[model samples]
Target chain A: MSLPGCYPLHDAIIAEKLTKYYGDFLAVDHISFQVRKSEIYGFLGPNGAGKTTTVRMLCGLTRISEGKAYIYGYDINRELVAIKKLIGVVQDISNLYMELSCYDNLMFCAEMYGVPRHQRKERVMDLLRFFGLEDKKHVKFKELSKGLKRRLAIAAALVHKPKLLFLDEPTIGLDVKSKRQIWNLICKLNEKGITIFLTTHNIYEAFRLCDRIAIINRGKIIAEGTPTELRKKVSGNKIIELQVSPPIKKSTILDNVDGIIDVNIGRDNTIYITINDAIAALEGILEIVKKLSLEIVMLNLRGADAEDVFIRLIDGTEKNIGSSTRR
Target chain B: MIDMLRLEDIIKAFYIAKKDIKEYYLKPPTISWGIVFPVAFTLAFILKGGHHAQEIIPGLIALALFFGTTSMAAASIVFERKIGSFERLLLFPVSYIGIALGKTLSSFMFGMVSLFATLVVVLPFILNIPTYSLFLVAVLILSALMFSAFGVFISFLIKDPTNTMMIFNSIRLPMIFLCGIFIPISSLPLPLRLIAFLLPLTYSVEATRFAINGNYDVVPPIESILLMLIITILLILLTSIKIRRTIP
Candidate 1:
């Protein structure tokens, strides 16, 4: 199928109630969203939140149990061949052939993507140079470092000149420097006019990389908006993070505290208390900790950001669904 | 089969096959396994068979091809599955059948080369006979393809490459004993001979015997060749369907 004129105008990805089931368990529940052209759309959620499953369905790696997805208006099920031409996927594992050299690996992808015979070599060399992998071109993939392998994996995906790229945890399991390097590449790729569909649990990554953020948890998109817009949605709210010794029950904090809108047990024995007024909420939290004989290790009062918005949306979604939807 | 014929997809499949050959089967150790194992097996059997060595050549040659094709055709894909490289192929534009066939092509080439290597070592002893190279070549080609497809079908039965290979060897070892690779079907009991006929290797070795020794009593050369083609087609279709289940 010809890919030149397949697009029905803008909107790079349109997923409507896209669902997936692994045997009897539901992995992705009817989640719908749209990714605008040349924009980075992120699915931000914690682990096992159906983010990877959604991305896999969009890339045609996994079958959709229900609902529909259209890539540039091309149906995923019926028009996958044409869709494959317009999209590239970089899975977290960097699943390129490990035994082949970096040059051979890119060359293989170029050939498989049906690049013109004459252009395969030049395109591969260009990618090697672009990714700063020219020196490592002859090195086998297994011999390269994790950061270099990730770069080569991204380079392989871009060899076909795909318009829409699906990055499933692009900076996953990378060191600080490697993660920043990947972040730069992502922005540079977006500047070159490629639409990116990124899924990550990294709050910093989503905050810095995405043009629009969708908060997905428990197989659904609870909230979707720009980073600033998402932050703005919760800006009226305030957060009091309490790092306490001998943590108390979240229910205890919620039950005794007045003016506390919500309480969640966070990682590392900390608690995130959402409130409208930080001063009044802090007094109530301190009283509860003192009564319980708990020592306050640290406390911080801050305005809501994307992470706060994420926790708020997830908390709201969990309460709205409640025990009836719990699996 | 029609879907496998698309020009671009077929070209992509060839490249996939090329990559597999380069990464897995073309290594010095692997090529040595393909070449040396057959020659060594032939020598061991010739010395053991003594006066019967002349008749054992055809069966050993068939055994060489069988081992060569089935081992790699299945191992390569399951290895990729373990290493996660096969996921890349699944995500590519190539059809499921194309990927399966690409694996088969690599194994088929390997089996053909093994057949040639076995023939080179044994050809001197058989040169005294009025051998038909065309018929022998035809039978070897079809058998290699059939054997390769058979391996592809079995690969879908397991996930881990190491376990898949273990199961493959367990099944292959039985087929070797049951097939006429060591014993003549004509000399075996009726039940054993019937089981041999049910196995693809029976026809492979019998047709080989007919081509090399001008003997055609147990099974006709053309019928054996035809059976190999039909079995190959059936297995290729089965393997393609099995490959599709990977997507879900």
Candidate 2:
């Protein structure tokens, strides 16, 4: 199945220093990465962090200003037809024809990708059933709910049975249940041997779905590794959870306590602190609480998570990139 | 590169055309712009001119086709861009030329259908002579092709839907008076006549006048058809180039 290319046959996507510029603004810096076959590779970044631009470049929706990219051993620029046949992209918006019925929408996609006429109907129906949208097949896309619209968009992308699926913010604005369902669907798609390239700002979604994650900021990829590897490499902060009877500001113990990286106030008077050395920071935190006459209702030590990693990275570059990049 | 001349690409173009007709031309906005706008303009001309309606009928029908093809065609693509659906079309395995042809084909079909539907009502009142059916059909097809390609070009150049309509109307509104749609081209001022000669619609209107009334005074029908075909090819080429700039 190798398409006569220099890139490894096992690699589904290989982007080498791909760049994009919008007028004078550098939207994507010299970025490079690879996605192996059937693995869910996540590009985790905040808004305007160039994740979407990178995906667009790789998909040939936007031209790469410099360098090269290959999809299943086909060059993105020279072999766009071959690359397009190998890929499907679910954009940020579920942008199927609003006037067409769900069944018609998928059928139109099947036609666009040149799915064989005899097999198109059956493929569309199978996708509808898989997405739990068979009952809404006859309904116009505009009449469907946001969740259904998103689901149909994904189904439409799969009509031609793409090998590498690009999902840009797959579950951006969804309820907890709908998001979880989409997460499960993503897992199912990956299990079906479809290589997934996911871009998201959601920490939990990235942690839950991605096999390996790349953290990007200011148009540059800062770090990339597996969930466990990311935690071990750059996500080395210790998390301390303390619920005080009297609520205190996040900055109240900043100067008084050393080794504390960042602090966030959670629900129910609980405070989550990301620190370098938990032993020294915890003693300093206890003394500060005693001096302030605030009772510690509950105190527990927790392992570092995606949030701690994100805050650690954001805080590390706060001086270089002015204003908080966290959203 | 995918060849636009390939059979597979042509089939894909037809697929895109079918989708566009079903997804855009059947909508309320398209129906209103494609048929009602031209009919209203025709009605106004008929009411104002009274007995002179016979002389202006051919031009009016040509004018209707001009507006019918351009207005909704531009609106459909620009609206797709606004809703982010047009980008989806670009992601498909179709060439830029194929995409332009598909959009032009859709608009051409809509223009022809809408014009004939309007003609059914108007022709009953004006049917007194043996009409040149085949020649008229040929003239209609060329005019539709020119306008449809022009509209597709406009869609590729302008990104916003409202702004596209504004630009189309700004050009189309003035064309009605300039292209001899209601007035006689021979009697127009020298400067205006020169301007009219520069417009593609002028030849189309003149050819329609010949096909409907057996008059070839302003311009010859053969020459008019030749000019229309040239303009259609040019517009489609320009549209494909303009749309390609979106990628790089």
Candidate 3:
């Protein structure tokens, strides 16, 4: 299916059938996506879904097994040095200098990027303040808490003010406060006109932070859209949950209901029904309950969100929704 | 622009050297290996007797320099790699050669400092020995450079720091025995002498002996210097290749 505006709008990154293989195992299958300039694009996937591998391939940290990708129109394989200068990568692991103090780590990164010496000190200090790590400047990286270490890693990556930032699971294994802080930092960075390509397994983070997201599963792009768009794709059906007083055994009675699409009965005697129209299917559901003489204690209707869309898509139950997926 | 790129690499190398020295140079393990071990080893030789000490003084100094530099260099690289900073270094725009040179230079400096300390401790014992100060300093610097390159090369080959030390001990202990450090190369049997010829430390020992005693074995002092220079270059080249491949 064609992606909306997939024609490359001064694209910061573009991948066409990008693939990777480790020995005989295919780690990443043919996957294609584009990230536009100043866009906050999220790569959402589960563990070992090839999200990290794809990010590495884009940043020139790992060799691509097949297909092509470009950063600012430069071929990823041939123009890596040029690409390296334009992008900053924060890997899944906090790969910073543990022996060096926070200040030294930022300074060293600045020097490596050829930041002018006159501006180096100022820039490092500014980053320390920006990340709220100014007081921890003298502390060795190993001595800091895990959240501070991650903040320092991100600070070091931005030492050169890269045009595009690739953050791989930036909020993984962090406290809620730290996660929220990092989320604000990400938004601030994007506001300064830097393109962000974030890979995350946290469904809420993707929904809250990303302007557009692509769901990947088993090394392929399963769905792609804004959170609202994705939620809408699963909106044709509504979910109704019922708590019954007397536990009903058989759900086959609702199979003949005209508008009921699917029925699931929980061990707690709660029946969940999915239908194209909740109002149209409610009478039929109530009729079955009446026949069984089971009292309906409570009824609730839940709206679809990104999480629901993601679960339905990954579970392979919403096959019709993904066939024409677009972002 | 080309000049700027070259200048940036030089600056980066210096930065790495400075960072390494600050982080690992004066740490307890470095001090123990660089200062304490050499002094203890030298004192052991001196306690054996005056005559034996006189004969082995130069060898002891060479041993000190070799072990001190190699250990510091290998340990630093392995530790950085273990802590995941080495992979971060690879993400920067610096050349592989710059990184190798930065590490080599720091290791070489550590070796030089250790050698000087060894000399200070050995000074009072000797009464009359021929002195060629300039040649001696030159030989010592070249030897340190060669060994530092060797250390970096070995660090790249071995991933784990503990395993690297194990392999380092196995390799360096044999080199000390086979090199002309304790015994002159000519005194060894044919096969053993052949092994001595192949070791870089052999050239360092022979050249140092010639400078101090006005006598040489195997190759002349000038040839030994040339061989050390060649080995240093070859090792540095090999280290650059290794860094590029391993990091990429």
Candidate 4:
């Protein structure tokens, strides 16, 4: 059966120019975005980049200073009750009651969300097993390792099966294996059509999990798009680094190198060339070295990634909002 | 509204409170406050005044109730803040009323346990009077709730646990001494009497004194109960408002 449009306007989440000020400082400047149904929208930024502040605004934990945020067609400030009912948040910290057992913690959350008495036990057990925490059901939260604690936090947050899940730096302090597992779980949840709003400084996690990403800096959103789109919009395909035995001296040799857009000289005598094609640029640089009788020590090539776009957006000289903004 | 507080939430609160109370007792200094100080003060004041042991017994009980309840409430806040449980609760569908009720009830329950244990130790030696017993009991429970709410309010206002204790001491110590918990409020000067009235325990201790000594002239039992009820309501209202705004 097709759902009716009259069934209330549900877009999962819409944050319109949401701004938050703490004293005189703007923690979240005028920023706006929307997460459609079943999309894992990644909020990408550096440490003090206001991503957490934006998440806090959407969850209604912090009041918005200027604009409005809505969840499931309900304005956060005006309809907080309805918004809170449909949303689940996994904050950076593990806020589970350390003294309570994992089963008890899940049950506590289920009960608070008003799951029926008979259904609570089944729901609690399902969530525990889903997170691979069934065996540690009776262990106190404090005794659990950091990764286990994060998993338990996720389990407790999902006990009510909310529609829009907000995960703020969910895998920040976890081990590599645990982080990969969490990434898989997040993807699984997204595949089940649960809209995920994630905020993190880990570019690789965002690349792996997010369907689309917004890069925030200082307090404003600088750029936003899918991972593939972001890589395409930012110039350059590969980064070529050349460490020479006797550092080649010349501003003109690099300036004349074709396909190399930017050259960065480091204090350690390593030359970093941002290029359109690594294969073409590497051949050209080698030809110049052969002609000049220059000695080559080490060469490294890496593909452009979100971290590249992020750095260019924040620290780069030129600023270009992606094509999506104009359209 | 009561349904808003889930059985699981209460259970969680209880578990946390139990662990907190254990940690509290395990600390070397808290043992002195829990066992040594109350007993020492009870004996020191009771013996110093000879037949005045009866006069000081009710006050000592009220003092114990205050110390036990407020300490638990403060510890609850410190632990919750440290664990970021307060932020977790704010993210949930639960209302501020639910959080406040859970916290208040948990601290009050733990406090009563401490008070009961202290009473058991002190009861066999006291005068064992039954004057205005219901009124005294009512005041004890009411003052405990009010002070616990106050502790929670103060907890949200400060960032550090040590700071919470410092602030609690600045506010609670004066109330203990001047609120007729250790002496008669009537004997206090006019300025101090106003300060005593600001404390919920003053009316509590006054009623307890009346219950124990049959001295119900200056303040009636009904008047004391009314005062406590009004103060308790206002404190809860103010605390709820404060806690709601302090969520961030």
Cα-lDDT of candidate 3: 0.82
Off by over 4 Å in 2: A1-6, A234-236, A243-296, A317-327, B1-3, B43-51
lDDT of 2 by residue, B18-44 (tens): 888888777776777788888887877
Model 3's CAPRI class is medium
Instruction: Give the candidate order by descending TM-score.
Output: 3, 2, 1, 4
Candidate 1 residue spans exceeding 4 A from truth: A1-8, A240-273, A278-301, A317-327, B1-4, B26-33, B127-130
TM-scores of the first chain across all predictions? 0.82, 0.88, 0.91, 0.87
DockQ of 3: 0.55
Give the TM-scores of the predictions, in the order they appear. 0.88, 0.91, 0.92, 0.88
Error of 2 at B213 (Å): 1.6
* Candidate 4 lDDT over residue span B88-107, tens digit each: 76766655655665566656
Q: Write the residue-wise lDDT of candidate 3 on A220-245 in tens digits.
A: 99999998988887899777777887
DockQ of candidate 2 is: 0.73
Query: Compared with the true structure, what per-residue lDDT tens digits does model 4 show for residues A55-133?
Result: 8888888889999777877778777766777888999988888777899888777867767779999999999999999
TM-scores of chain B, in order? 0.90, 0.93, 0.92, 0.82
DockQ of each: 0.71, 0.73, 0.55, 0.45
Across B100-183, the per-residue lDDT of candidate 1 in tens digits comes to 788888888878777778877776666366488788878888889888888778877787666765687787777767777676
Interface RMSDs of the predictions, in order, are 1.0, 1.1, 1.9, 4.0
Q: Report the lDDT tens digits of candidate 3 across residue range B144-242.
A: 998898888888888666687688878888887788777777889999999888888888887787777667778899999999999988877788788
| Pairs of colliding residues, candidate 1 | none
Per-residue lDDT over A217-255 for candidate 2, one digit per residue giving the tens place of the 0 to 100 score = 889888898888877754455667788877876556656
> Candidate 3 chain A: worst 10 consecutive residues by lDDT?
A318-327
Candidate 4, superposed: residue stretches over 4 Å from native: A1-10, A235-238, A241-252, A265-270, A276-287, A294-303, A316-327, B1-40, B47-50
